[model samples]
Target: MKKATIKDVAKEAGVSISTVSNALNNSPLVSEDTKNRIIQIAENIKYVPNMNGKMLKARKSMTVGVFSSSVSGHYFYILVDSVFKELRRRGFGLNIVINKDKRALLSNVLSKNFDGIIVFDNERVGEHEVELIVQNQIKTVFLDRDLNGADVSSVLFDSYKSGYDLTKYLIHLGHKRIYFIEGEENTYDNLERKRGYTTALKEIGVEIKEEYFFKGMFEESYAYNDVISRFRLGNSQIPDAIVAANDYSAIGCIKAFSRLGYRVPEDISVVGFDDIEVARYFTPTLTTVRNPIARQGIRAVEILMDMMNNDMPGVSEHLAGEIIYRDSAKAKVL
Candidate 1:
């Protein structure tokens, strides 16, 4: 059967093509009853509006949206900056949104206000939201989400390896009393990294200490508070080292530890993931996992632009993390 057109909808509804157009666009010129009749007829006949004409009328915006669950912290800022630069180089505008609510995020994405969108890893996004992406046929590149669906592709980081490699390195340094600053326990990155940490510890016969684990919200203040609270709870001795989920938490731990007259590496070694810029220049210089943050940004944009321009699904990638040793952590002394 031939694809239905506005004329077909107009004929089926006993209305003019112009009226059908108005109804399809939800123009107020059509009465509510008439609009509903036209819409039902259009749906029945599978008629689609002339989006190309509408797009041409407005002109290509060359704009894309980038949504992140949290926009603060050095990690996100660095990634945003990199993504911005990449988009700028390609003559595409980048609109960044901090997704505070999943419902609102899905609404904006489904609105088709941009050519395409890149979604950073978000635990708040559920299966229903992913189905919306498929339902609307939105061109989306998911950063670290690894969602499986039509018109939804992903860019992933090997977070489990990121955690395991760093943890194993700390173990190699003879640090058995390793405390963990876990970030958003429910998040995929945190879970993967935690697995790696535990795996490395288990291999070396070091039973993971439950008391040494602190919950983190992937922020500096939370980590800072947790460290301070532990000290106030009559803790005089420090763990051999603390492995934080991210650089922000690690920095917070280092600051809190420093304020308590504890020197990093000398008093308590610290390790972090995501080698943000400040991590390399902090007081003791953080030892961290180089998370390819900039590359992640660049890759996200590349994939998004490819999908937008070629109308193709971009290939997914799983990048490995590497340990970058610095002054923040040193071999434990026997």
Candidate 2:
């Protein structure tokens, strides 16, 4: 079987190639009846248009690219889902590429295959690449880092405020000996949250102890092992409360404490950030911060569209997170 093209559609519909092309492109020069008839013939012949050719003609791909390192966690899942839905609603296609290679990622961004791009991987997109993107005038919206300049915008979570509020809430609950399970080192969100936690503790005149910090790497298993191993070494001095980087880490800490014959919110209080779906259903119902994951995606697309269509200048927006009190954390027993 032969593949049908615009010429084939024109021949089958008894119209010229230009007429067929105009009809397919929805040009007003073609009448509605002729356009419908040509479209029907094209569909009947199973004609597939060349997207690259069409993009070249129109000088627009009508697609947006999302670049990220990994879309493994619940946060990313919700964010991508929202972004796809919003793009579809706006009559745009989505292209997602997950690559840890900086060179490859930069190459894709410079290819100009997409009308705009949304970035999530901070490590892959460094200062030099960002400068190149600006120089090329490639419209981009960054979700992980706050960056605002020509042809670039950013949508970020107010992690610092969320962290400070959570810490202050725990202090209000009379928790003094507090511990923190840190996420990936040097990541924007992780660093901001840690800064907030430390600043709150400092304001209260609480001495920051290095031993109180544990490595979670934003993984449940890592947090679980870190907590369990520390306690297994006969370290009897347990903190009054523990704060995890995210909900998964918080749940891991809870599990570890449970296995050690400790009850959450009773023997020790635990709190986390990012109110993931399972947070509400967990045994102790995570006391966590509700990050606006979906909102961030929606805003990123909106900003990118504006930049691509209206040549709008880059803008920075920060969404706030609210602490949801649950069964996992409570006041200390004085």
Model 2 lDDT per residue over 1-334, tens place = 9877889999998999999888766678999899889877976786755433223224378899999889888888999999999999999999999988664676677777888899988787877667667766778999888899878999999999988999999999999888999999878888888989998899999999888899999999999999999997776588999888988889999999999889998989999999998999999888999988999999999999888778789999999999898899888888
Q: What is the TM-score of each candidate against the true structure?
A: 0.76, 0.81
Model 2 TM-score is 0.81
Give the CA lDDT, 0 to 100, for residue 164 in model 2: 92
lDDT scores of the candidates, listed in order: 0.79, 0.87
Q: In model 2, how large is the Cα lDDT of residue 116?
A: 86
**lDDT by residue for model 1 over 1-334, one digit each (tens)?**
8977788888888888889877666677988899778866765666644444244124277888887677877767888899899999999898887777554565566557777788874665655566556655677888756663446678778998888888888888889888889998677788888888888888888887778788777889999999898886565567999989999999999999888888988978899988888888899999998878788889878877766676666576777888888999888888
The candidate maximizing TM-score is 2
Error of 1 at 272 (Å): 0.8
